[model samples]
Target: MRARDLLTPFPTVTPGTSVIDAARLLADHDLPGLIVVDDEGLPASILPGTQVLRLAVPRYCQDDPALARVVDEAHADALLSSLAGRAVRDVLPGRPRELPVTDPDATALEMAALMARTHSPLVAVVDERRLLGAVTLKVLLDGLLAQ
Candidate 1:
């Protein structure tokens, strides 16, 4: 199957989108990640849920996994509240992730290869810089495993 055939309508956020909104979108859709679209409506980056969680966990806790258990879980929950004023771009790491994009006509194997090479959970299917939809890992696996 081609990317266009496999893709499903997916939500997108701009670089200026609030982290709170983006987090909510992820939670509501139960997505592995949301594609970040540029002002030109082109695929920009992938905002993985893990990266958002990273914003809540203290640096010390990340540095030492055991210390996470020592801290009160409530404090960690409170930190998530602090993300309100921040934008999606703020959550991106210092070194940006490569945009995982596939052409609409690309084959399933091509999409799978791109996901594997980039370690991304979803691939945005774009046609001339315009996003058509996305092919998620689960969808791809379902198609392949159905064989």
Candidate 2:
């Protein structure tokens, strides 16, 4: 099957989107990550859900799982306050990871390989800079298992 066959509508956010709002979209949609689109509506980067959580959690707590337990729910919520005014672009790494973009005509196996290589949970299917949709890891796994 082709990557297009496995494609499904995926959520996207702009670089200027607030991190808190982006996190909400991730949670509400149960997505592993979001595709960050540039002003031209082209895929610019992929924001992994883990990255959002990393921003919310304290740096000290990140190194020590035990420390996370000591932080009360209120404290945890308070920690996220830092994300209030921050935009997604601000938190992105100095060098963003390469985005995994596949042609609609690409085979599922090819898309899977790209995802594995990039360590991305989803691959954007784009044709001539126009995004068709995305093929998620779950979809790929199901297709593989079905075969």
Candidate 3:
């Protein structure tokens, strides 16, 4: 079966939303990332949790050489402090190359190749003109196991 058979639709987010709000959305949905949408409602980016972690570093420790030296001594506190006030957008990486999407007709091998190339755990399932949902490695594995 195609990935769409197991796909689940989730709420989307806009790019302009602050990282703080995005974090709240993630927490509410218990998601690791969100499929960011553009004004036209097209997939734009994937904002992952690691991006938030990087932004949580204290500016003093991140920027000042003297402070950077002390960070080795007070690393834990500095890191925690950095995360307290930061926004999510401040840390997210530039969009990585995404996987090639396919319609309901795509075969499992096609999905596997796209994942292999992009190292993506999930492939965004799309029709000729619209997005549907994502197909994850877990979905693929589970389907195989069920057979």
lDDT per residue as tens, model 1, 1-147: 889878999999998999989888989989989898888887788767787777777899899999988878778668778787999888775545556788888898998888888878999988975889899999999998887
Instruction: Give the 10-residue window scoring lowest on summed lDDT in candidate 2.
Output: 91-100
lDDT of 3 by residue, 20-56 (tens): 6776686787765566766876667655544454466
Tell me the TM-score of model 2: 0.91
Model 3 TM-score, all chains together: 0.65
Cα-based TM-score, every candidate: 0.92, 0.91, 0.65
Off by over 4 Å in 2: 77-79
Best by lDDT: 2
Shift in Å, residue 129, candidate 3: 2.6
lDDT of 3 at 88: 43
User: Which segments of model 3 are wrong by more than 4 Å?
Assistant: 57-92
- In model 1, what lDDT does residue 110 have? 90
| Each model's lDDT | 0.85, 0.86, 0.65
Error of 2 at 101 (Å): 0.9
User: Tens digits of per-residue lDDT for model 2 on 82-135?
Assistant: 789899998876554567888889887898889888888899889887888899
